[model samples]
Target chain A: MSNFPPAGVFLVGALLLPLVPRRVRAVALLMPPVASLVLLWILEPGQTLTVPFLDFQLLLTRVDRLSLAFGYVFVIVTFLGGVYGLHLKDVGQQVAALLYSGSALGVVFAGDLFTLFVFWEVMAVASVYLIWARGTKRSRQAGYRYLFVHMAGGSLLLAGALIHYNATGSLLFEPMKGGLGATLILVSFAINAAIPPLHAWLPDAYPQGTVTGSVFLSAFTTKAAVYALARGFAGWEVLVWAGTAMAVYGVVYAVLENDIRGILAYHIVSQVGYMVAGVGLGTEVAINGTTAHAFTHILYKGLLFMGAGTVLYATGRSKLTELGGLWRALPLALGLYMVGAFSISGFPLFSGFVSKSMTVYAAEVDHRGLVVLLLNLASVGTFLHTGLKLPYFTWFGPSRPAAPQTRVPWNMYAGMGLAAAINIAIGLYPGLLYELLPFPVDYRPYTFAHVSETLQLLLFTGLGFWLLIKMLKGEPIITLDTDWFYRRPARLVYVIAVVYPSHLFATTERIALRLVQSLVSASRDPIAALNAATVTLFGRYPDGRMPRRRHNTGDYDPDRYRLPVGVMGLVILALFVALMLWILLAR
Target chain B: MKSTWLVLVVVTLVLTVSGDILTRKGEYGQWWYPVPGFFALLGLLGCMAIVVVSKLLGRYWLQRREDYYGDSGAGE
Candidate 1:
């Protein structure tokens, strides 16, 4: 226990998950996260688990409040997500879920950049299966892009780690000094944090993920990036602006998104933007705000994705334009989803009211006037989309409800119920969440001014949503984001790299097709082809075009006999090469 | 639902009117702190601007047909 990392429970359990028998494997999926929670609870801060490898001591678990906060949320979501996916028979997906949650825990507990990179990659690789588990053409394609983007992020992290190690001769994952190495490390975290252009992968992939899969997806990846940013790039002024930009950028896209999960996905970007801005502020209040937000966000956001996923699960469609008037049919999902919606909209007595207020308060405390204005504006949009627009369009809008495809499993409700209860619990007594913060801050969330301010903002935003409800009606269109820069140009790159070569081969095949026809005909009349070949190399037949001897090639008729196209291509290609060589030798 | 919203509206109005009685009488951070319903205005106008700007941006520049990337995975 002293040497074993908390993440081991999930890693080992993932290895054993397939062997647990499919009947119980789904139930068995809950064990690792439970075990991980117990271990994280027991594991004391300042306890370090390190393994010496190749002259480097790899610190796998560096227990601290920050890591523990993330560790607790990560495990809790895994458990809840496992419950959500309890009806799954796909052992591959179950194992993937376990490994993914495990690796994210590994990342949180990673005490060194090298260890962080290893788990960073494992998290990326394992989480992608969640998307692919959906087993649709779109999910498959989204999975590839998701994989490629994260790999690029991982590579940057590795390069940064190596450069930092080289420059400082220390691999301790602490506050980074100004240099190329640290900058690369910051950029890597920014990509994972979904800071604009590097972000499109997240919203693109998460919506395509399996219903249960996205619940866990919503918890880990970007929050881990938020944790990394807090650890490595705290106090960087650039993050203040960058994070604010992302905060606004995400909600704008959320307003425009048609997919239920995509709107939620964009909100992830917006919410993480608050954490990123908090890390930039680098005060005790700011850091605490980021950590507190990440902790509560995992609960509520997981709940939101669950609600959206449930709608998808029951109706077999996720697009807003394709669904509506479902509140009566899906009352359980509707009630649970509204809890999440209220929590996220920062309604008093909800978790977001406790957490999101802190970060905005931090901006005010820091005298960042513009940051305060923009973030408050983002709060308005957050309510507009996640709270009002999405629920209205999905549950009570013009479209008739699609029929339920399957009964929502008991465990899905169990998962959602547990998360909803926790969100409320934290909102009721934020002291519970406040205790887990990495730093001490004398902050209160329930002040009359604070409560009234949040309520007014959210309520008035609701009024705006009511007025523009017609315009906010989701059309079946996707709004382009920074990802358009790559996803669009990726086609041109594909044409140059793959398409052009294939077309050239097609042209070669066309030239070869005629040669093969002539050769096949020549099998019956060898004399005619030999005469034609003898006339070549600028030589011409006396009858102007070529000697036409179609009837005499009696054994081979184009209509009666057929050779495989591939065979004809190869033969004609060989003949042309040889004929060119012979002509060269003769000359 | 209408009564609930009406109650919420009443509560919000009462809180704003009694801001001095319900809260501290000092600057919180910004100049708008003294003004009642300041955040309410911000929320309304901010929501209005965001919806308009984002819709215009999406329709003119960003919005695309779902199959814009094409079903063939853009020749993947």
Candidate 2:
């Protein structure tokens, strides 16, 4: 029942997840929550235990309200995602999910940044295999990009940890004053949260992952970063802008995407924006908003992805262009997905409206008028894309001729139904959500003004969408985003500037080698020499010039030796190399 | 092209003006920046206006094919 034992149990379960016999993988899936239940029930708040390391004692777990709240949600998500992924059949993916989710759980409960970073990097390395599990060339490329981005984040996190340790001479994960160390840690966490410029990977990788794999991917990384941000940099104030930037950025990009999964992927970042801005405000209300939003976000986002995943599995299509008119056949899935979409758009009587408004409410109380206003606009934008575009394009648009209406498995429906029910349950009753909040809860959500305003914001946004559709007649297509800056023209520049030159240099080297071989062969051939003599020495007399040039042995005369074309080519090559080296030396 | 840029410039100006107005309250003819909230509002309004107008203008410029570059899985 000790903290070390729980860690050991979870670690062992993760290690054994893939090694188990294929027939029993489903049974093995239940191991994670059991370990979680043990940890949760055994470790009381304020309980501390240490494992002896070389010169210091490593605190295995420090149970607190913040850590406990995150731990509880992660455990629940693991169970739900596992149930959704039951049909995955890929043992490697199952094990990776377990280990990756377990490591994230370890991070929140960790007493220090060192423990957090260890699990942080583990989650990064373990999760990429999920992307690779798709077994396509695109998936491979996405996996590689995913690896580089997360590894860069890990390095930044390590650097921040070292800087913080040096500054405070302690590794405890607590609030730090603004400095290079703090900024490094914050930026590092933001990258994982999929902040702009670095955010392309979220959509790129998540959509390419296996149908079930995306469910797990959606919940962990951003939420873990939120936990870290809450732990280390709460009330720092800069997060408000960062969070706001991300929220809007996500909505714009989501509006532009055609892939259903990609649309959901962008919304993940958008929803997290509210949390980041809330935490940045750093009041009791703000922090509570962040935690509450995180809890609700995990459920609704997972539900959305699961719905998209079901479509992908049943139809073998995910792009909006190839889908429509499934509302009749997959009514259960479509209905569940709509709950998720409504919750995300912050509609009245849904989870998003309750949780998202809390952040805006906090901003208003702090007299943060601008934050409140922008967040409201983002709420409207969320309504436009997720609320309207996602469900409309997928289930109600112009129908594809042969779209499938196959029934999804029972467990998948069970998982989505469970999450959607909770989403609605929380929306109708904020008290349940409030009790789970890490901080003391005093905020109310059922006021008449709040309800009316939320309805107005969402309805007006829907009206704008209708107006745009009527006036401009915009067709649904995959609009390019920040990825274009890196994927297209910039990628072209990289190829020309880097790959093209290297390829050219390689070709030139091959040509030079061929030219040298031709020269060496020509020097050894008498007939070739005579032919060369006619062209180079005499210009018109071949027989007479060769007779006059005949030496004692087979052709050792330097005068008879006219430079072959191949030799001239080699000379040109040498000159070019020398010039290149000279230029390099000069520089 | 010219009209799109003009629209973008106008939106940027509107956003900047709104940002300034919100950041500064009419407090005895004195003006100051209202730090994080001001920038957050700027970002939000900028994103929304960009979405609405872009959708309007994208109708003119952004042409996409039903299956322009079908899933070729750009690879070796």
Candidate 3:
């Protein structure tokens, strides 16, 4: 009832959107970003409130530097995404993206674990409809897998929260000493963030989404999980290695992928790796890096998805092998894509360089040698695939006969341009991003030595790629990932498991059918004979019952067959005995 | 695929062996010493083996294709 709009605003909009005409839904979608901004400006910093009689309390909103920076970037992303997706046919998608993104923002501002969990599940359930909206069977199947993984993660989080409550006797979201409960919570975040070995869901779901749906999907789930990790486990040392593995793992798979959207999906896992590693470093500088990198990544990644979305919308193609020489027609998209590529590659004077250097610097200062080395290698791989290969193959490579030659529309350009401008602005003035971090900033990113070293590393990595391409003989086919573990073998297992029991039941049913048919055929003539005899004998009696006739032995009455009570009672007793036996055997 | 499986197996075995050797209890903080270093080296070596084997075997089996789903379209 307060002036502040409740989280229900988003949920209601999502449910009501499809009921509205398509034309009006586009304008109505603007509510989320506007509402998010108003809430941001109105909410004071260092705020806390607990409503009585509720296990979950509203953490109205927190406007610290970190939350403010993330909130602003998320709102901007949602706006650009709205413009980008204006041509979408489905209102369900537009509404879901808004609600999903807003709920994610809600989590970032949440001051307690209970409020965060509430928003967390909302984001998961709301965002998945984007994947399902693709209208492809592959996408539907992928959506199922996506839902299962997320619901599992949610259950783990809920269980961990209950355990944590028992251990700490409080619902406040604070850092915990590592144990079974804390580890469970961390694993929950790790699964969503696409941590290695459990990281199959990102590539599985994102590529199958509708062109614009992928753009919105890219921004929320994993990054929100990263925000939660930073909030809850900023200093945990293990995430350094976990993050580094994801960084390298994603890049390796990306280099082998032919699907343009798949490449971006894998890169999501890799980019978040930087933030995860930064969190593990557990210093103020590293935390700043996590926040800044997440902010910049959203812009650049959204830009990249926007670019891919343009290709899909215009030509109906997202595979690299099927797309080429697009720069000739879609020059705006190509240029916008390059801006995103440069930002992601951490090139000098781009968003990535400005943000990522903080983490590298923190790692060096902290003396995490192996983690530093893996991240460095991953940076090279990142450039090879996303920065260079994606643009090289999609826009500038040999022209394909099937490639689309149409120019993209103006709204698409506007979306990409907004994101590109933000990338460059953040790169040119890192302080703008630095001021909005969760903590005060004392670090500098533009020192001569820092800039020089970054250039040297990138230059050498570029050289390595050149030499490897020239010297090493490697295949260009897409490499299989852990997804095949479930998508193939596990799917086969599911089929066998479901089909096997059903197959046995089918056999039993056939036998039962045959037995009943034979029994029916055998009893037909005898039943007719018995009917004739009963009618003749019963007609002689006043009542419709025949008088009892003595049996051949003259001891028993023959009228018992007409007494259905005796026959039915005997049948009931037999069935009860059989059912009891079956239960005993089952036990 | 065979090579990848081989690498996975070898690295897991080496890690189990080394974890037994390296892992120990600590009085203050949980302590892990350098015995896992051997396992890490083995893993790096395994990665190399996988890259090499995948490269070699891919020449015969991995033909680039137009449809990755390998059917007219994917079954949902």
Candidate 4:
């Protein structure tokens, strides 16, 4: 049992899901995460499971305070996600969620870079299926694009790992010294972290994912990236400015977004920015703050996504423009979601007040004035959009025509309620979370000054929202983003390169065939053919001036122009030979 | 809605008046604590700036028609 990594339970359980009866599958899903939690506590810190691979030792289980913190929250979220998705009959999503969660655990516990990479790729592939499980045309395309982007990120990570291994002759995952390998690895992590430019994929694909799937999607990818960064790239100064930019950038986009999930998606970027900044600050307090925030963020953000998913589940719509007057309809969901919203916005008595403020305080102690200011500004924006605007527009804005409401599953509420309880529990008593941090906890979150300051900030931001309510109304329009550069132009380039060329080639081939046919026929009957050719060439037909030539119904037989089998074979052989020569000579 | 606004105003005033007595710690400490509604002002102005800047970005550049991607539905 000690030899088996905790992640192995989830992965194995995921495989067993299809074989079990439907009713048992939920219990099966719940068991692994619960069992993993137990196993997590039982196991001592340090490498536990090691296997001999081709040339390196594969360290599968590395239990330390850092990994265990992530592990605890990961298992908790997986259990909540499992409970939330209990009503889903789709086995594919269920299995994918388990695999995705397992791979994330795999990443966190991985003691070596190779082990991390394998699990990283698995996480990407498994999560894309969740998006595709939405089974909409939009989701299908989004999944493809999501896959494309992750593939690119994964390739970069592989390249970095290979290069790092080559340079150091070690496969152990440790703090990277600044170099090409480190830069590539950091970039790969940044892309997953949804640092801007690479960030559009989060807002693009996440909103399009299945209701429950998006909930799972929200928890894993960026948080895993945060974990990776905290372990590997702490104290990298560039991340400080980059993370500040991400914090502000995400909220700005969230403010403009109309879709509830899209707003949340951008807010993920904003919230992750805080963690990234904490990691960038690189002090013990800051790193602890970063991990602590990741812990709290997983709960509240998962709850928020669950709230949005609840809205989507009930109305068959996610856009704020199509929703309103749901306060009476979904008061329970509203209340539960508000807990998450307030926590994320750093309300005085909630989790964000405790967790988020630690990072801000760290920045202050470190004299990172600019980062503190930007993070504070982002907090204001967070309240404006998530804590206030989203709830108002979706639940209490001017009533639109009533949407056909579906009964929300009890499991969804149960999942959200569980998460909300934890949020408040941590908020009201952060010692519960702080004791689990890697570093010693010395910060206080509930001082009279801190409370008043936070209340003042939030309440005043509320006032601004009230004053600007009209200006803040959701429009039935899309906001163009960094993705427009690729999504639009890439398609246009595809048309020019692939579509147009193929069409032009077909037309040109037809014309060439007509010319060839005319020459061959002319050669067969020289005298008559010469007369006709002369008339056509001289622009003098049988009619008085020049009769229009009738277009031939060109029965183009492409088969007739096909190369002989022997010649085709030779051509293929020559190409193969050339390729071989290039490979051999190049090496 | 009217009552809500009225209550919010009353609460803001109450918090503003009471903020002077709270024990201050961390950045700026007690030096800035006595200033009435200091954080309230920051929050209000910070929110306004976020709105103004985001609106400007939307107006000049980011905002597009819902169908900006056309038949491909790529942006969705």
Candidate 5:
């Protein structure tokens, strides 16, 4: 484990993927994540593999409890993603997935800001290809938007990291005190965490990615941001409110969304809000809850995306309006998806129950009543959308008999089943997750009171869903989001500022060139040039006569100003001498 | 679907009743424990609020045609 960076396994696997035989590629893809997971468990906690980078010591592997926890889950999700993508024939997506997952792991274990920044950019560049590999015109455009947003985020992170280093004179990744640098760093992390109004990219791009690629996309990027926040800006009070707002904001948008993946993408914003709030609360249990939630969110969210992906793989549709009666065609997927749904809604005996409740509980203990209320409200909304509404409409709503049931790949089910099983296992035996948390486990999730209270909440939310079933029906319309502000205006601005100006300059240059050419040709014979200039300036010939036209009234013959070559030379030399004398006298 | 509904109702009844008997602990325990089906009411109202708020947003602000951003070539 000390021999090299753990992420190196995946990086090397990505490089070797193209050379491998097609028959063996799938198996080759699975090896790196497994190897990285093994390396994660074997590596000891502390900074290792330091190298001199300019004025700083680059700590490539910081094997602390927090990083290790993130590493464990990242490798697990990568393996699951590899299994889910086994059927894909696109080599570009395969390599991109490997690099993307590898870079996320690099961010997890990065000990210094510099190492983190490098991996941050690699994650952005690598993940955008996953969106592009969907190979749709819309996906191509969405990928560009995704890349631009992330590049902006990366620039902010770089700027913040440099300023932070300048202020502290150290590059070690640690908790930051309040200042412009810290605020900038926090804003950068907030962007990746998908806090509104910086959020729209996740919902914009994730749905546009390939099925398996969306699964990977959902797991890595924001979770890495949560890790960065937990490591760097824990206990910042502002995050508490921002995160609370995000929790409610995400579900509200998700409620109005028609696309299956769009709803889930927004819910990612909602779920991550729990972790951000926990980090902001800054209690031991809160941090513990944040880590636990991130770990479970990866599994359950990946499962949800996988479930939706399977639907997409089969029916070639992801909108709720087009999908129905999938429970019959994809019974296995329906059951597995419900597990994720229930888990995310914080139903009893599921991963979300054990993880998400801790954050709310921490807030209550801290006497942050408003935060508690907001988190609880968000939970109710979570159940309303993901747990009840999504499953209801996608699986059991109006039948679509015209749609063919395409065969889903076995590895897809295998991946989802594995994630579902883990979710249940962790939910039931939270100690399995608790021991991996950065802080000690003191809170219990399974008291009779908690169990009963949570059940009552979820069941009644189910009751609400049933009551509002008619109103909850999906429509074939899009709900404008913050992305609209950019999607429409940004294109207009780009055309005007960038595209139109360049085109205008090109046209102007062409006209200018033509005018210059005519001037140069006229200057070749100075007497004709002088005659034309005089005619244009004075509307008469140099001889005080109207310019004589040939057959066409406006056309003039060059013979009208024809002079001996010697006389033309003499005229040009005399003008030059007169200009030189004027310049000499003026000086 | 009927059986699922039946199971949900039964579960909700059992939990609400059992919650009445269970000893509550920690912050807000007094307020929450004394109120029968407190979380249930909260969940119900919360879900309703979400639907109402989202519907209002959709109707007034957020909703748009399927081609609201225009065709795929619009931005291009």
Candidate 6:
């Protein structure tokens, strides 16, 4: 059992997928995650699998409640996403999904920084393909930016791992004492967590991913970063404010976004804030809240992405301005999507209700008044944008004549139905989720006061939506985000770094090619070549280039171009002597 | 249909605000919990403010055309 780690299942499954017949590929996709879930369920806490490398132990499988909590969701989402994409014939996307989820699983279970770093980098490389799979000009550019950003983050994580190992002579990935290494490591996690300023890549890229790929994309990367922060940087005070700022930041952008996936992408930043803040609180309840929220978030967010994906899949458009009156056409998609919207809004009978309250309650208990207030405000925005604004303008707004439609595939519906059921089940019986939380729980989602508080907050948000509905419809425009700080200047950088240099290289290469051709012709007919060069250089031309019409004017004649044997031997001998003399003199 | 939807939102809002007000913050909620509809209005007004402020930011500062990033690479 120790010899085979859980990540190996998905990773190995990905490598073997092409061998499987195309017709059954989607069914094949479900097998690995199913196997991973069973393996994780059977593996008890306190299990460790270690492999030796150099002077350090690579702890590849560290099974405990924390890893178990993340492990379960990673595989669950992989299975759900597989079902969502069951209609896909694109093997590239299938392989990427498997590999990306496998790496995420690897990160959670890894006990050493080295192990974490390897999987961290693999996760980045694999997930970028999802964005690139769309093969549009926009997706191509976005994929490059996503790849570059994540690679930069991965580099920081690797540097932190090296520096920490050098200082402490240990690589165990656990809570760190403050230093350069820990700071670098925290920033790396922050980037992946989509903490603002660093967050623009997310909304920039996720909307560009393939429909099924976006569903997988929405589930994994930021949540995995949340898991890492929970493991490494819990109680770091800066995270409390950073997380709070992100919560509001995401909500604000969600309001402004014209793209539906873009709106959901921004909210990923918003939802992750609670988990990061809980990690910052570092209380037992807070950690439990963080884990529980992560678990519920992956499911509901996947459902939302699947819902949006169904819209995009059927209509071939994702912008809210181009989408409307879809309720008549995509009713099932709307119903399933509303389940997600309700869950994310923390409606009383959904999974988010059970989970989201715990983090806020923890903040209140910790007496962090500002974090509590700001997170609450973010929620108001959350319900407003995701629940009311997006749906209002999308499914229930005035129909656009341009929008096209097709019947959504059953697998997409099957995928969304499964996610919606899980969300409602957890909402109805909180213990279903609570039992899996890393810490013992005493929080209740359905207390008279708590439910009343949630209802007023969400209901008034709905009222605000109805009143503001006219202003809330998406314009056919893009909004500038923090990405503008980089994206606007990216072309300038491309010119300076790529365009100008390539142009210079091309000119140089042309001149060098002319010189090499001249020298080759000279070696063949030395007398004629020298006379031509002399005329060009000293009289006819200012430049040293031999005239193109001189020497071999017609097609090359191999026999005529050959140098004499004696002259070739002399040249080789001269080259050998020069090399020997230069070596002797330099020594 | 729109007016009916508006009325539904209003009635639900009224019911929840009253329920919150009736519930006792008797022992331990902070000063604002005693205020009926405090969170409700906060939700309403807060989201309204978010929309207004965000739109203002968009109009003045943040919004741009789809090709704002020079995505076509034409001029570049």
What DockQ does each prediction reach against the true complex?
0.48, 0.07, 0.05, 0.50, 0.53, 0.53
What are the iRMS values of all candidates?
3.2, 9.3, 11.9, 2.8, 2.9, 3.3
TM-score of chain B of 2: 0.35
> Clash totals for all models, in order?
0, 0, 2, 0, 0, 0
Q: Which run of 10 residues does model 2 chain A get worst, by summed lDDT?
A: A545-554
Clashing pairs in 4: none
Docking class of 4: medium
RMSD of each: 11.3, 15.3, 16.0, 14.4, 9.0, 11.4
Model 2 lDDT tens row, A1-587: 46553445557887887778887786678777767776776677788777777766777688877777777778888888888876668888888888888888877877777787888998998889888998888788778878888888889988988998888788777887867777888888888888776677798789888888889999998898898888888998778888988887787666667778987898888888999998889988899899888988998899999999988887877877778777776788888888998998777788977888888888888877667766777777777777777777677777775367565788899889888988999899988788878788887887655664565456546545655543322245656555555556656787889999999999999999999987787767866656666656665345454344444223444555577778889999999999999999999
lDDT of 6 by residue, A20-127 (tens): 999999899999999999899888888989999998889998888988999999999999999988989999999999999999999999999999999999999999
Q: Name the better of 2 and 3 by DockQ.
A: 2
Q: Which candidate is the best by TM-score?
A: 5
Model 1, A1-587: lDDT tens digits are 85379889999999888778779988899988887787887888899988999999999889988888898989888988988889889998899988898999899999999999999999999999999988888899999999999999999999999999999999999998789999899889999999987898999999999999999899999999999999888899999999999999999998789889999999999999999999999898999999999999999999999999999999988889989989878889988989999988888999998999999999998988899889999899999999998888888888675878799889899989999999999999999999888888699999877887787788778778778888998888877787788888989999998999999999999999989988787886775565455555435443344435634432323543467788989999999999999999999
For residues A1-587, could you state the per-residue lDDT of candidate 5 as single tens digits?
36378878889999999999987787789999988887887887774888887767899887888989999999998988888878888888899999999999999888889899999999999999999988888899889989999999999999998898889987888999877777878888888999999998999999989998999899999999999999998998888888899999999999898889999999999999999999898889999989999999999999999999999989888889888887878899989999999999998889999999988888888887778878888999998999888888888888775264689989999999999999999988999999999877899999777787787788878888888888898988888877888898977998899999999999999999999998887767666667677777888767787755632323446665577788989999999999999999999
Each candidate structure's TM-score, on Cα atoms with residue i matched to residue i, is 0.88, 0.79, 0.78, 0.87, 0.91, 0.88
Q: What is the lDDT of residue A586 in candidate 6?
A: 100
Better of 2 and 4 by lDDT: 4
Write down the lDDT that model 5 would get.
0.87
Candidate 3 lDDT, tens digit per residue, A1-587? 22243344555666777778877787677676777677666655555444543655555554466667777777878888888876666777887897898788777776666777778888888888999998887788789889888898888988888888888877777777877778888989898899988889899889888878888889988888888898889899898888888888787677556678888988999889999999888898898888888999999999999998888878887777777787777888888898998899888899999888788777877867677667766776677677767777777766786456465667778879988998999999988888778888888888654554455445444444444542232223555566666665765686789888899999999999999985675476554445445555664233354545532211223474477677889999999999999999999
What stretches of model 1 exceed 4 Å from their correct place? Answer: A503-587, B1-24, B72-76
The lDDT values for all models are: 0.88, 0.76, 0.74, 0.87, 0.87, 0.89
Cα error of candidate 5 at position A356, Å:
1.1
Candidate 3: stretches off by over 4 Å = A1-9, A12-21, A52-63, A405-407, A466-477, A512-587, B1-76
Docking class of 5: medium
**Highest lDDT scorer:** 6
lDDT of 3 at B6: 64
What does the i-RMS of model 4 come to?
A: 2.8
Of the two candidates 2 and 6, the one with more favorable TM-score, higher being better, is: 6
